[model samples]
Target chain A: MGNLNPIQILVDTVSVGGLYALTALGLGLIFSVMRLANFAHAELVTCAAYAVFALSGQPVAVAIVASVGTAMVLALATERLAFRPLRSADQTTMLIASFAVSMFIQKLLIFTVGSRPKPVDPLPILAQPIAIAGAQVSLLKLATILACIACLGALTYLLRRTSIGLHMRAAAEDFTMAQLVGVRANSVILAAFVLSGFLAAVVALLFVAQTGFVHPRLGVQIVLVGFVATVIGGLGSLPGAAAGGFLVGALATLLQALLPAELRPFREAFLFLIVILVLLFRPNGLWPAPGLKERV
Target chain B: MTAYAAAPHAIRPAERLSEIWRRSATLLVLIAAIALLALLAGQADAVLQRRVIFCLVNLVAVVGLYIFMGNSGVLNFSVVGFMAIGAYTSALLSMPAAMKGTFLPDLPLWLGAMQVPHMLALLTAGVVPALIALLVGFPIMRLSGIGAAIATLSLLFIAYIVLGNWDSLTGGQGSLMGLQTYVKLPVAAAVAGGAVAVAFWFQETRWGIALRASREDEVAARASGIRIPRVRLIAFVLGAFVAGVAGALFAHFQGTLRVENFYLDLTFLLMTMLVVGGSRSLTGAVAGTFAISLVTELLRQTEVGVTLPGAAVTLQTPAGLGDVALAGVMLVIILFRPNGISGGREIDEMWRRRAGRKHRKLPEERNA
Candidate 1:
């Protein structure tokens, strides 16, 4: 085995972290507004991947458009169907319902499109190796980093500079108060779901491009990591969620590189251990939403 | 103040005694229902008997889950993880020394050579996971709501990774076979009955009441001097204990063990059972288990084409139909009847209300 390259490790960590950040943002946005930890977000990613897979023969732009469209529709549908009825229910109920929705979609996918993984190449150009400063990097890694940065920058501008974004921030801070101040709860929530769906679609496209395969469970692990990040960032804090995502990705990469080869397979266990420890120290999260403090 | 308290105290013991009786009756009702099923299973074919036993096993796990989730109102995703620990622990201790040496040669010398009686191994299975929960719960029970939920989910993933990769003791991805097949209908039913009683007794305790109060309103519970985390931790460990025992029962029932058996599929199924029956009461837990078990069994049988007695039509369903149907049923229940089939109330509560109504009606007729 060759010696580990620091720059290469940095690139891999950022690439993985970028995907997780997008997923975390999606989860965090919905949670901030509705107080629901939406497990069905996994299905959003899975649907997008499947959409891309089914449209693999089409141009890359078309596949992207179709996948994004499918994810947004599914997200909006689940919100309208399963979640709306239980909108006033407690957090646990909504969470379990989301899991049901997640499982429901996964099984539906399996029924419709077989359980076996199907290989597809939507953007084969991204798979090529590129050298940067004495280290080998895939074009996919660079694209992933750039895409993540662009998404993050655009999201920041939307939240800070846009009126609807201001309303969203207000809702996250206090939904009742925001509604009292003339924010339309339904439209704001719909906007959150649409954006979440958009993020899931982006992650799905990148994930499929990297792995070259699509399966019913392509999103479960990603969602799990995203969920942990959401928790670590503070339940309803968006920037905190993104940071937690990068933190997890970086920690995982470091563990993989630093631990002895025999212990490498246990990296996920260690990463989760650290997550539990973070909760122990910061039970509310690194950046707890301000509204949570009012509860006590 | 003393005189005012004394007046109520005079009537309190009687009220408490009746309360105890009522609660015991609820447990008796649950046990009797399980016993009836066990009796029916005894008279059935081997396959049917095994299926009923599995339902009883699921009851144990669900009731264990209900101990924490039902009372604390926190979602715990680590139930299956503790089950995995319990299954592997029991499998290791109960397997013959020679077989352990052959398959799990990397186990510690003492563990590799150990071959305990089945009952003792089963008890140890429950104890081991309880100890782990005691350790893990200290950190986990501190967080509330989604924070605690995600922490527990991480715990589940951690357990999966470790159990699946630990080559020596668990045989890695390979199945561990040749365990004593001691969990029959009687055993599973008895254990499940014991679990129900344990859950009921705990729920009636001061700690359980306090935990539930906190679940209703954190600030109010704290105002009443409840140490929320302490009670939550107590329930978490106890729940883990019961779940662990359930896992051991499952291993012995099947006479085989694999890491995959304790992962997402089992987690999803058990969660469905808990949520469908209602996650807030012991009765709901038992009802949910039986209900989903019946539903899944019916759906699975349909997959092979169930034939109607008088009709010429046979219902043919595709494979994996049961899961899809189960998910759909769970979603509908969560949406339309969020409190679950039991409406989150115990069976005795319904009985009491009906009895009270009958008594009231008699007085009304006399007055008329």
Candidate 2:
């Protein structure tokens, strides 16, 4: 097993982490602006995967557009109906509401599409593979990494440059002050949700392309992973969430490779142990928002 | 000092009556319903009785939630983790030798050899989870509000991964079987009743008051010389113990345990029960458990047909449809009455109030 190719594991690590980073970024963006962790972000990703699967015969670009659009709509509706009302309420209410929205959306999908796992065909672009660094890397993985970087770059540009992004930043910093400065909190929040939904679509495509199937429970695992990444990066920091995603992704892969054969199956558990340790020492997270005192 | 002494005299009669009703009626109904359910269980079929017992098991879990959410105002997303610990621990301890040999060959020699009695094993299960909670709570309790929620959620993921992979102890993805089915309807009901009664007693105690004080205003509680972290730690540990006991009961009742059975989905259901019942009251805990459990059962049992102009649509429900429906209804209730059905009162307080009124009249007549 030690003689087995290291390159394959490395490739798997990067691809897995890249997918996680993509989804975690979307969740982080919403958290940054809205200060509410969108539990339904996972379902948004699931919704995207289903959208792609439903549009299988279409052109790849068309399928991608439809998936992203569907996710955006779902995000918008979730924000308007579930989260918007609770935003003014306490944090616990919002958190519970997000869970409800998550369940509702998942069940709705199950009711419509059935609970069985559905086979998904990878887009034509992902069908090819390229040899790199003494290993075979699939086009799907390479594209996932490239697409994630592109999304990251685009998000960075938007948050650092665009007016809407500025309003989002302001709102995240202080909602009351942002409102005082004439930033429409609701619109900015909606934008955050839309952006998150778009990210989820990208991740869903990548995940389904790799796994070749989609299920109602797919979002549960990803949501948990995304949440851990969000905590590792910094609860409300976009870059931190991305970094955390890749970090956990890489950690998970490494543990899978390095753990004794008997312990290999507990890779995710090992990663969570690391998270618990980080949380213990750095309770504020790895990159806590500056100038914010502990609320307690 | 003189002005402060006159405060009780200034209290209005109407305000006092409203306070009494707020705290007592909710508990009265809860106790009466429990008694009614217990009585019905004697006459009910095996299947229906099992469902009632399931509700009772859930009552234990929600009682744990009431301690943390009700008293501390913190949303714990990992009650299922403690429940998992409890379930797995009890299942492993009480599993028969033949079953242990097949799935848990790698278990430590002593654990594999030991076949502890069911009741003792269940107690051990509860203690193990409590100990884990104590260790986990030290740092986690520092996180307030949303941060605590996230941290505990991580704990849930961690627990799931461990339970699923620790094949030696937990039997991995396979079901752990051969445990004695000792948690019958009577035992479950009694445990549930005892748990609710214990919670009520705790709520009126000094530690409970301190925890509530911390929930209301951490800074104020700290200034008042309350050790906030210590208070939260105790609440968390106790909550985990209760959840563990519930898990133990759950394992014995079902006669098998699976790791997947106690994950985020179960956590969501438990949270719904707490929110729907009212996080603040012990009665709310029981109420939420019964309401959500019964509603879930009804939804799964009820069949619906919709006739349209040219077509008919029929829906065949699955086992846990009621849980999902109750979750939906509770979401609406949470939006409106976030405090829950009873506003955080217990069942015993109702009878106590009536009895207190009669006693008060006798004392006044004797004094006159």
Candidate 3:
């Protein structure tokens, strides 16, 4: 573990970084459009994970489809039922409401499914180690990197080229102004939720493949890391979210490789300390979004 | 911003006295309510009495949370982190030398040999966390809105990791046991009442008022020459002090400490209490803790299958329903009453409004 193999470290960093980036995008998309932090985004990831586990008996394709469908439906439902009512309320209220939704789903999952983690191997093939440049990297890591790039590229295309995507971008830039200019608030928001749900579903698949288990809290830690990435990247910036995720992921991996054995257990503490230091220097984040600056 | 700012010079001495007297009513009412609950629990079985003590501990923590979040309008997620710091600090200080020697054998001689009085230990608990908060808040409080919240959340995770992994000092995730359990209902209630009074007093001060002004409109507050970050840092440190005391109370109450206790679950539980009551006012913090504790108690009873006095049926509820119901209640309250059940007004405000309505037949006097 002490050996500093460049290829292995690079693969590990990119794989972890890619997953976090996807998670950040899912959260960042919603925050950009609605100004809601959407703590319930964790529930979307968890529901998708559970769906895959529950449908593991089915064909792999069916399990994947069901999980993706589950995340999307749950995301839409939460937006409709919990968030829509608080649209006119302040940001703090929305954040708390989302927290309640997240808790409700987590507890409900525990009530029905129990808190113990259940192992599921929906894709054993991806776990196989493949030789790459004198380093043994799991096929899952390669797949994760590919998936992250594909999703980000596809999302960028959608935002740049499509009418609905343009509407979303406009809304994110300025909500009230976008409404005045004829962007449909409801549909654009719904589209954002759907796309976020798709990203979360992808994250769930990749995360479960790596961890080999599904549990109620599978999403809690990752979602928090994602939320932190979103903030450090720049709250309302898509590309910034990606950058923050990669930065956090790379730092964490590097810390894991470099810290002494006794200090390794404190890696997250060091990571968070660095995050605070970053914010101290750049209070607005590394790539602050336009229109987010505090104005007199 | 000027309209919302406190009129420091407008009130005459007599009027200021009356206004202070009126605000005291809120603190008095809160204290009386807490005393009433403690009194009732005193007569109940040990279990219920313990639960009430725990509620009061939560009240202290939530009120500490309110001191910063209510006034500054920034969600602080690191209160539990401060609480963890407090708990560990208190436990390490108050534990008997023999116990410490056995558990934390590798401890430095000066720290390991010390065995302080419980009160002194508790005071140190509050002081240490406040010092830590002063250091952490200096940088983090400069960021507003989500940036601040995220930074504080990281603080919490950092605390959890450090406490969980510091094996020599913290017993490495195993419980730190055999501490003096001095937090009886009276001790807890006294601290809770004291926290309420401190919260009220702080919010009425110039710094607190300026913080609230910043909370309402940051740009306007900045334009009015208020230093937002300084006031925020003040409240953050003071709030950490209160949270640390609450943590000490929790440690003595439980007679054991675990890093897990001072993590996400406690963080969210205290948050629910603060927000469900109202994060903007002291009354909201107290009321939310009281209401949620009552609801959770009932749910827990039902989960254990409560039997009526003479009925044959047992009212059995599935386990884990308490958490789900608490979350649901918080969701409903946040939706229907975003300012909480207190609506962000103090008890004195509600009282004055009633009196004002009654005096409508006469010519109106200037409102304080």
Cα deviation at B196, candidate 3, in Å, is 1.3
DockQ of candidate 1 against the true complex: 0.78
DockQ of each: 0.78, 0.52, 0.77
TM-score, ranked from best to worst? 3, 1, 2
User: What RMSD value applies to candidate 1?
Assistant: 4.1
Model 3 vs. true fold: TM: 0.96
Candidate 2: tens digits of C-alpha lDDT, residues B1-368: 02112123454668565654544455456556776897798799988888888888998889977777788888897789999999888888888877788878989988887888888988887899899999989878878866788878878888888898777788789887777789987788778877776676566567777787777678898898989888888888888888898999999988988999998778888888888887866777878888888887767556343344565655556544554576578678867777677655455444555466532222113333
TM-score of each: 0.95, 0.89, 0.96
Better of 1 and 2 by lDDT: 1
Candidate 1, backbone clash total = 0
What fraction of the correct interface contacts does each predicted structure contain? 0.82, 0.59, 0.82
Error of 1 at A23 (Å): 0.7
lDDT by residue (tens digit), candidate 3, A149-229: 999999999999999999999988888889999999999999999999999999999999999999999998789888878
Give lDDT tens digits, candidate 1, residues A182-278: 9999988999999999999999999998998999999997998898887778879999999988988888788888899888889889978988888
Which segments of candidate 3 are over 4 A away from where they belong?
A: A294-296, B1-9, B357-368
Worst 10 residues of 1 chain A by lDDT: A287-296
Looking at model 2, residue B238 earns an lDDT score of: 86
Following a full C-alpha superposition, what root-mean-square deviation does model 2 have from the true structure?
Answer: 6.1
TM-score, candidate 1, is 0.95
lDDT value for model 1: 0.88
